[model samples]
Target: MDEIVVGIDVGTTKVCTLVGRVEEDNSIRIIGVGIEPSEGIKKGAIVDLGAAAQAIANSVERAEHTSGVEITSALVSLASANVASVNSRGKVGVSGGIVDDYDVIRALEDARTIAIPGDRELIHVIQRGFVVDGQDGVRAPIGMHGYRLEVEAHIITALAASVENLRQSVASAGVEVAQFVLNPLASAEVVLTETDRQMGCVVCDIGGGTTDLAIYVDGDVWHTMVLAVGGNHVTTDIAHGLRLPIAQAEEIKKQYGHAIRAEVGLEEYFTIRPFGEDEPVQINRQELAHIIEARVEEIFSLTLQEIKRSGYDGLLPAGMILTGGTSALPGIRKLASKVMGMPVRTAKPENLVGLVDRLDSPAYSTSVGLLHWALSMSAQDLAPPRRRRMKGESNMNLDAIKNFFKRLLP
Candidate 1:
């Protein structure tokens, strides 16, 4: 089907809208791409709906102008900030003496039965793998004979208010919310190879507002997290340390930021006028690297901490894959390797075919990946044909559910 699909990545620093045309050969041709500076959003949460909606509209209009296709509905890449995850299992008896689609559906439904808080909304229920009877790791169990079937799934949830606010902003831009795909999951769709995933690895998407983490074990997501720290924090550090404007600090960080200070030379210098300064100050390049390295180290440190928290830090034989805007900084992968004590590499989308010059960057990983993810889900017909009765519930929908529910609850 030659369908036109759109994906809008609503980031804290930028809003990127991409329009792609699915060809007969199944290749997605990038017809349009629009990226605009984000406003009314902080830390991936919509703080001002009117301003955020205007930004979305601006991005969407640009894409429409370039592609000549009016977008009515689109998939969104959601930030993982305040996201919660858990692995769940569901089992059902085989019907008609064999495991069929209905049986598989029932198993998935059973897996999704978890105690979700009233303030949280379920976004994704991903099947990690399956089991037939007592045998495990069944990728496809349909048509297999078994008295019982079980499914292991990775469930992702987001704050309900956050999701609704984002939807309202997108609606103001005149686009219906087709689905909300997690940023890390979308990025993983295109960046992570089958071998990388099977061998086990971690994906760190260091964006402007938050550092998103995804750990893959046995070729499926084992853990997901969004840290309230990222590239913007690094910029803020530079701004404060150097006494420069946030914009200028950001620009210099893009030009000279490095994660390894030892590699920088003391003789190298960059002239910049600190905020409220009449004259420019010649600052040592190594000093700038020092400031940048401090924050970069923290980002990687937190990422490693999360991996260890997942109980799979030592299982990642494939090491870590770094992407996102912040991952583009120089010496990032090397620093990652040093900090995490594992092999590390920077990556971007490699599977998309079209006007791909801009999309082939770590920053656009989520934006381009959403195209592949959204279309794949559509083709798979992800929603079940019917719903079954839920099993016993427990408060396992998010990360502890202690603070989130307590704050929102009366």
Candidate 2:
């Protein structure tokens, strides 16, 4: 029996369904991956339930065919302009002058007891770090002698209506949504290394309708935000500026778009089918680059503003790690580095094996991260290790795998 886990990434531009089998070393082996152009969704929110459901069904069917397994449920990525975040604290007294797992659980429970609005639902309550007896920056308290325990946590919230609509659409497709994982956290799980997190870094995922940002310091998430600007906005600018249709504009952007205008020679040109013109119109490639540059700069500028607002702006020395669909643009690294005044690099999911080579690209980062996040959380829910298991120990337990999924949901 294989421990199979599925991840569904519903984005503004496409819907991706991936089926992964847990291997002997607890790594993911890609068995099947399906993708199709997204419709009936906008800016990560469901606009038409029927259309969204059909897209989900088709993607899941394609993946199932390749994996030779029927997927009844999946872990979905949660993203939208409505996501919000806040930090809170909780404290509890230790029993027997020692902090135990139960005491840590109680402290966490108390930490999450903030007065969230009824209209908004809590998505995740992640601990930043814990303190024992007023001692700050305590990473682990279990088995430690302490009279008091305190926890500082970061809470993420989302609009109930938006999340419910997304869940309904997935349900309509006949697949249950096991949980709604935050998009930034998912993308960061695979892209950022532990050293990067410790040195402070920002994971920026440039999707079609949103640019998700997650900041980490000392190996804990300190800030997160989702901006309502992305690749689609740049495409729209090209379409309107060149009088080309949206499809053609998108094609031109991917085929010829550049982030820096100064580097592109003015003599280089690309042809496009302009509206009301029989023959194609020749446009200066430099001009196209200029148009893209403006929008890209604005996006980065807004991102910088958000960093400033976070007040942890100066903490990240490791700088930015860019991923997602839009980060594939040529010279994007240079543009981001120039605008952000920090080191910039592009990344995709690197912790993959088996039939997943095709998924080794920026566009598939979020999708891969979703499955990785689920597997990690599932591992955390297991019993603690007592020495090492025998060499013949079996890792394939379907009941335990099913229980893993059950533990993931709220």
Point to the candidate with the largest lDDT. 2
Q: Please, what are the lDDT tens digits per residue for candidate 2 over residues 1-410?
A: 98888999999898899999988889898898888788798888888888988898888888899999898889898889899998889899986687655576677778778998999878877778889998999876766899999988888889999899889888887789877888888899789999999999999999999999999999888888889899999999999999989999999999999999999987999888899999988999999999999999999999999999999989989999999889999889999999999999999988588677678789888899988877876665544232323444545343453333223233
lDDT of 1: 0.84
lDDT of each: 0.84, 0.85
Off by over 4 Å in 2: 382-410
Q: Write candidate 1's Cα lDDT for 14-50 as tens digits.
A: 9999999988876789999888999998888899999
User: Looking at model 2, which ten-residue stretch has the lowest summed lDDT?
Assistant: 401-410
Using TM-score as the measure, which candidate wins? 2
In model 1, pairs of residues that clash are none
